[model samples]
Target: MTSPAPRDRVDELTVGSGARLEELVDRESLGQLATSFADLSGVGIRVFDAEGKLLADAAQPVELISYLSTLKHSRSAIESTVSSVKNLDPGPEGQAGIDGVSGGRYRVVALEHDGRRVGRLVIGPYFPPSLRDIPSQLLELEPALDLDRARQLLTMAPRVTDDSMDRLARHARAALDVVMFSGLRALLTGSMHLAAVRESYRELQSKQDKLQVAYDRLKELDRLKSNFLATVSHELRTPLTSIIGYSEMLLEGIAGEITGEQREFVTTIREKGEQLLTLIKGLLDLSKLESGTMSLRKATMEVAPLVRDVAQTMAPHAKKKGISLQAEVEAGLPALWADAERLRQVLLNLVENAIKFTSAAGSVKISARLSSLSTGGSADEGGLVLLGAQRTAVELRVADTGIGIPESERQRVFDAFYQVDSSSTREQGGTGLGLSIVKRLVEGHDGTVHVEANEPQGTAFVVAIPLKRATLRP
Candidate 1:
């Protein structure tokens, strides 16, 4: 026999205490490869316990239950002979093959690695042991079955060389090592993936914190600027009052007679003082809007009457400048739900700016009609439908053939204290707060204000106010 001739030589592969022999199998790949090895062995190579309990078996057909049962009984004797070798350590204990009966008997090979008896393999179903000739048990199963024919079929198990069996056991051990290494690789991959995700989460959290901090700071600075303007404008009003009052008194010669030249200069002073007062008031109103302190007293009022009233109030100023001022309102317009005072202020401011900027003989027209809006907060221009009166809004546009605001300056003009032609002291002479105050007051009434170019001519200021304040509720 070309076998190892050393059934008991298994002292080298012991792992540790309390661990079972099956733990030595690499669980992930054990099922995959054991079947392949069984096919190559060419034997009924089955693993079983000392008492013949089946563990794993190859070369066994599923349909042959009766034959399998017969084999089970036959394999026990083989297992018994293999178990005898378990007592010896790491060297040849004994030979376990059956003596020639019908032909050659099966061998029960005790499997050992590193001096530990791990399991037993039945390389058999061949011939019976000569010691128990014919193994009387087989004949007893069915008297009619041929003993000799059965014996011939049973002995056809693989006849591996003894030396080759030892080599095969080493092959099985090497295959298990490869499977265990692959398992380690999978574990490493999973660990790396988990680490990457954790790192990404941490980086995102850091960036979010920075953005939140920046936003809060910007909000704080904006509020501070509003408060500053409110305080400064209030203080300025007290002094401006005396200047305008005394200048008027001087013009009228209240204390004594005055020369024509003196009267003319005093009148100019009084008028300029009043203009300063208007600018100061605009600043205060804008601050109120910015600080969210503006109060709205809403009423249901018709749009046509308001349009007529604003244009009439602004007519004299427009006429003096030789600018044609006109009022146009959609007849039978539905009433508006609005803060009457704030709405009036918005229209008046737009008209004043139109009349003030337009040159002689240019036209300034104030028009009102229903406008529909598709967006909330009135932030962007959108598809809008005017409903009963106007479901969406009333757009009051003051169009003028004036020096049009540059595209870059249009958005900036609505910013507090910002203007297109502003210097330390501007030549046009109105505090730059007019449009800013107008914008804030409009928004306070749940409306919006912006400027556009009067095509081919000058600028148009558009004020769109919602009939109902639905965006923010108390």
Candidate 2:
């Protein structure tokens, strides 16, 4: 696992009298500075914090120390020199102190931040270039000390002047400051990025909560609308049925002999009553379908006769509109498993709409065929089978050459009371519930219906009903 970040030390390094050098500069940068300076000036370097804790070091060669450790007196003196440098106090005017040891001298420079002492840098244990012979301290440390060998080892140590060592220490501190500044910049940038991301997440969550509340409100309103439609249609249907029955009686002369003009007026009243009754029935059917209470009497029946019957029933209406109505069924088409009455109602609605919308001299055609439909499913299965499978369905298309529905309005036309032309002076006369009821009835039979653009002109209503109940295939 990665190591945790260093303890927080901003206050210790930034503003207090007890500011620490190790807090101001990181350990990695300090070690690099010490190594670079020792290499450049040929001097041993070590770093310590205000608390006298050793942080980094690039000590001089081990050959001298290894040789001296063989004698107790020389080893003790060498360790004392290191301890003195580490424990040294900050000198006046940021100047370095040079102290002589048994073999050489150590230069201790105090480190400061904001005019306060924080740490120290020790660059020393280097020999003076003017040295002519082995030191007296090493010669007396052991009886086994070889004078010739000691002299040779002393030549191997780096020899530098006081001025050069002081310059090297300053360069090391300047380089470390740059590294510390870069590290602080990276930490601040990361904190800002984290805060921005959190804010965006909170805003997104707030929008989602609002959307959920709106969706729940729409659901409750829809339920209320369904109940209202069911109640109003039921109440209006009884009186409308009575009005239509009484008007039929007066027209047949059962109550009295009506005059010529009275007959025309009575006929208009019955016709208008019938129209109102049709609208009320549409509302009732729609409410039942929405509440999942509509019942269908399903059966397996031939498709050809049903198409021919719808065409025959609507043939007079098509003639009145001067539109040509035709029906075609593919030879040997399969029978459909569905509610015959409901299917007949679906055809009647499509054929009636096609005839009503087409202008004079226009054409409306009804066609059906037995076709294979590809339902969504995978081809291969290891143990579990995929969901949809290939099946045979009775496909029907009722197409017309009329003022075509615009692409944008085609889907909306299926919604109840949603009209392409809703203005008061609109030419077409429709309550707009016909197609909505037709859609619900078709889906109730496990069938699909959709409208598409007809070539050259007008719109086409396409429907597919499965020939048999859909099932998994091997």
Candidate 3:
């Protein structure tokens, strides 16, 4: 005949030495099981864990054992039997027995689960049918014993055959196996869950460490790039200034008489040189802004005058391009706390960009008015206006009828070196650093700048500066 299939088993290593009998099954449930079996079988029962801690006990008072306890020598003999029973090892067959002092016997049965012994059951102090009377050993220890009374007490003990007691012990062990199996399943489930959570946390922590390292590396690279730009821009400025000054002198015939073509060539050289100088200056300013080294000499200044000055300064360039330039300043506008020169540079850059993109017939308008600035929401939504109270600010709008910027590209316009028109053949000429510089300059004064579509056509660049002076970062 074919052998029965081997039972499925759990890995002993996974449970480890930490698995305990008491943890697998509760004492209250074990006590109830012991009580029920003891009541029905007329046998005393006790349960203990692997560590020898008594978990449950259910035994009816035996008159014989109680009477023997009154005699000093008999009580000593009884205590010795109880101690031996507690330390008894139920060997490979899983059961053992010992004789008590009162002619009763005790059975020790091993409790096992997953091929490992977790606890033991003690079924004890029950008389066997073969023992018809008290043993001579009990009388030898207690010579003053009343024979009649001792005999009466001996009859009170439960009597059963050896085969019957073995069967009862087997049945009780089987019932306990069910409880232990259920408890083991629960214990294993909890252990596995805890292991899984710990593993996930370890993986997450590893990824976070890698991300932090990458972030720190990027910051260092950015610092090095800023330093390079500052050094190169400073070195190029002195030579560039000489080139511009010489070209201007040559165009005015300072280098002796020159032909008409030579004059035009000299003029072109001067103009291009000036443009290069402007780009280098922009790069220097950007480096300073990024490194937080630029200083602002802030003072209370009127917005109306600043707006009119920007329009006046750009009028000649706009007229040359046949574009109408105008400034609309509201009367009695609040004074602004800002650096006059930096603010002028911001206005000039915006107006220049407007004229560069607008057609000959288009108009450019610079307007200044008193407005309420709200510091409440995210920068992308609009001004910061969602979470803070309204504060009085000077709002300057540089609107122009130029080729309008697309909605998708508006937010990116303030990024350094980014251009809406990046093709080689694009009409406008710029280093694309103007708006970036403008943004930093305005922010230095605790202000905000943003772009929107001009009504009907073109684009509007808005700058809002709060009236109050804030401590500026270097």
Query: What is the C-alpha local distance difference test score of each model?
Result: 0.64, 0.77, 0.87
Residue 80 accuracy (lDDT) in model 1: 58
| TM-scores for the candidates | 0.62, 0.67, 0.80
lDDT of 1 by residue, 35-137 (tens): 6666665434555433444556564332122343356454454345445433323236423555322233345556444454555555533322233334465
Rank order by TM-score, top first? 3, 2, 1
lDDT of 3 by residue, 215-319 (tens): 999889999999999999999999999999999888778889899998889899899999899999999999999999999999988777787888889999999
**What's model 2's lDDT at 125?**
80
Identify the candidate with maximal lDDT.
3
Per-residue error (Å), model 3, residue 407: 3.1
Off by over 4 Å in 1: 1-201, 377-391, 423-427, 469-474
The TM-score between candidate 2 and the true structure equals 0.67
- Lowest summed lDDT window (length 10), candidate 3: 1-10
